[model samples]
Target: MIDWARVGELVDEIGAEDFEEVVELFLLEVDGAISALEAAAGNAVIVEEQMHFLKGAALNLGFEALAQLCLKGEKAAASGRADVVGLDEVRQIYRSSRLQFERDLPDRLAA
Candidate 1:
């Protein structure tokens, strides 16, 4: 669900200070994207767009669970199965992963 190795690599690539800043941006941006996704519920086109954007962002940040959920939702939206997409699960997974990243990122960066 979470890709700690990728996260570590990102921290290393960007340096700790920049990595922290990037993480903050990711959290804030994804929070807004998730809210947009929730609000787009029942609208397949909007849902697909929201999920597609979120998927890319989540992948970059190693939010694997959220990315996977977004991928699923995006595919479903494309197939006109948007109603079957689990928005709640997406939200839950995102929240859990976000919390995990927030809690562990500093330590990981320090390491």
Candidate 2:
């Protein structure tokens, strides 16, 4: 669900001083995207584009579980199978991933 190593790499690459800002930006942007996704629901075009964006952002943040779901939805939408993609499930996974990431990041980073 979370990739601690990748998260550490990102923190190192971006520098600790700027990590919080990055986290804020991530949450802000991802929240907007998720809202758009909800509005679009199973719309193919929106799902394809939004899911692609979500997948990349999620992977960058080490939200592997969310990224995987986004990838699957993106592919399905791209293939004209948008109906099979569960937007609710995607949102649920993101919410869950975010919770876990928030809960564990401090300890994991300190360690």
Candidate 3:
């Protein structure tokens, strides 16, 4: 879920303080997106848009698993199939990924 190398590179590119800011912003945005996605359950149109945005954000932050899950959700939504992607599982994964990033980012930035 967490890509340490990418995190390191991000920190190097953005500087530690800016990296933290970006992480915080990402968390805030993604949390909202997750909520929107949950509320959009069974709504293929909304789900597709939400999942697409979330997936792109996740990829930028190196949340590979979350991004892949979102990709699945996006495709399923595009196909008009609700059963293919589990929103609950996606939510859980997002929460786990958020927690892991919050816990690990400091040390990673310090490094």
2 or 3, which is superior by lDDT? 2
Superposed model 3: Cα runs more than 4 Å off:
none
Q: How should the candidates be ordered by lDDT, best one leading?
A: 2, 3, 1
lDDT of each: 0.84, 0.88, 0.85
Tens-digit lDDT track of model 3 for 17-37: 898789889989998987887
Choose the strongest candidate by TM-score.
Answer: 2
**Structural similarity to truth (TM-score) of each candidate:** 0.89, 0.94, 0.89
**Tens digits of per-residue lDDT for model 2, 28-94:** 9889888888888678999899889999999998999999988998999999887676877987898
The CA lDDT at 75 in model 3 is: 94
TM-score of 2: 0.94
Q: RMSD in Å for candidate 2, one decimal?
A: 1.0
The reply for model 1, stretches above 4 Å from the true place, is none
How many clashes would you count in candidate 3?
A: 0
Candidate 2: C-alpha lDDT: 0.88
Model 2, C-alpha of 82: deviation from truth (Å):
1.4
> Least accurate stretch of 10 residues (summed lDDT) in model 3?
102-111
Q: Candidate 2: lDDT of 40?
A: 85
